[model samples]
Target: MTSEEEGLRFPILIGDVGGTNARFAIVDSPDSEAGEPRIVRTAEFATIDEAIAGSILRDAPVLPNSAVIAVAGPVDGDAIALTNCPWVVRPKGMFNSLGLSDVVVLNDFEAQALAVIALGVEHMEKIGGGTPETDAARVVLGPGTGLGVAGLIYSRGRWIPVPGEGGHMDIGPRSPRDFEIFPHLEPIEGRISGEQILCGRGLVSSYRAVAAADGKTPRFTTPAEITAAALECTDAVAEEALAFFVTCLGRTAGDLALVFKSQGGVFLTGGIAQKIVPALRESRFRAAFEDKAPHSQMMAGMPVYVITHPLAALAGLAAYARKPDQFGVATRGRRWRA
Candidate 1:
């Protein structure tokens, strides 16, 4: 164990809360491994309190002294609300309700950024041929219920996370096929954004758009159905939709890499990426990622991988909870500590 983890108090509660699920775990001490995470479907609970009380805390061996929660939204103000879920996470309220002394909330992608350093080759599947620069910036972004983006910069012997709402950025067509499908998306979303074509909802939207472009009617209403059909080659429109989705994801990922100059690498995570790994391996994804002129060579040299860890965000939150100063994460909520 590192010296940074030596000073943390025992029984820390950590969580990775997203639109679709809430995963929680407990670490007996900073130096000890976090326990197996208990996952709860977000739709089953009306509030964060109910989910926590009914799941992770229900059969706990001991009460936690502190907590760190990685939430899927911006975490700047006093009011912490999830972008896609109805739950609102208030630090002070949680402190009082859970009877915890300290609580720290982090943006979900920020947690992902922190987890990048802890990830090993075993946890990653390479998407392209490139070596990661040890000291440069690394980016992590992927589509799930929504698109999440974050960057990690190495400085002063530590990694700092940079979080932002990158998924909402406007996205445009890059290829002839993309152009053909663009008009169809405009009707679903007035102005197409990265999230419009790269997320779960986006997957369904892509199927509808591709079906219309192919002069056929869509039979799949959910992303899961479309993905299954596409993978099985049971529906031509679904296959086309999946291809389009992968290409758009690659284009957006490349854009993020350029913006962050992530020579260290780009790591893809989230539910959608994992489920569509086969589709992402197709040529279109890599081709689109390296399509930028004059910088195509530079882009090719940047390593890309898909993160396969199930509890990466939770582990990241635990890491930050152990040493907030090392990560440069603001521990404002710790002020509530008794």
Candidate 2:
């Protein structure tokens, strides 16, 4: 049957599952918008099923017939494992245990990519560069519990979400300061992937590395503490570390833009990006993003934006669940038939 003919059965459960928290909401019908998402701490539940049972099912107006869960990991095969969380999501098992008709799983960034088209100007803060090119490829990426990367391409009059483990790629130092700080991070991160210096744990690593490089002891032990110190200008090392982090993030974002030829834009999302907006504006983020020689002019014209919406992934999931074919996506999640 056509996806429209097989329209999403309501009430449908939609969730943006991350390492730290899971946000869920319910939509009454295919045409209706999803309700405000309720957030549940990932640490509160032993398994994803328990989390779902405690939040969406308990408070939802009615038990959902189907669900779309966007997770912070690769969605391949029947068993989906989260990268920074202990939750292992078995779709078939969830279908049986929850008595759902079907379950759809998506990489968190893939969900973010889908959200881009639905986002309004109020939902996004433009960082730099020119206006986005119509129908061109766009990239969405950011750092939170972990780094995420995804590409959105317009093909055949539809947007296609390209999901992959792009954050695990090796990060190379491009500046003198970056080169000087690289050795200290090498000991902690081994190979120095993008996630090594761009995530929550990576923030602490950056702070420690910056402190050690300057022959000082690190006072902050957590990413939050470091960000707080940096924002308040109470710690020089923390401030420098945060600056360095933004520069690296911009550099990596620029690389991804080139990789995908994302003239449409490069969107930044995730908790960390929102928290560090002031810092990003003050840092060398824009300069770093447009530092590609030979193509520096080309890079200069690519717009960058930071998505501010809290439950963007859920909106994307809702959209996909309602009309999968419209976005050039196949609804092939594990289904339960009894």
Evaluated against the true structure, the overall lDDT of model 1 is 0.83
Off by over 4 Å in 1: 1-8, 186-189, 332-338
Q: Which ten residues in a row have the lowest lDDT in candidate 1?
A: 1-10
Candidate 2 least-lDDT 10 residues: 329-338
- Model 2, runs deviating above 4 Å: 1-6, 186-189, 332-338
List pairs with backbone clashes in candidate 2.
Answer: none
In angstroms, give how far residue 285 of model 1 lies from its true place.
0.9
Check candidate 1 and list the clashing pairs.
none
TM-score of each: 0.94, 0.94
Tens digits of lDDT, candidate 1, 1-338: 44323334568888889989899998887677888789999999988978887897889988788787888998867678899899998777876777777676778899898888766789889898588988899999979888999998988888889988998898887678878888888433477887788899998888888888878988989999999999999989999899988888888889999999999999999778888889888888888898877899999898889999877888787777666667766555423444
Could you give me the TM-score of model 2 versus the true structure?
0.94
Every model: Cα RMSD to truth: 2.7, 2.0
* lDDT, candidate 2, at 24: 88
Identify the candidate with maximal TM-score: 2
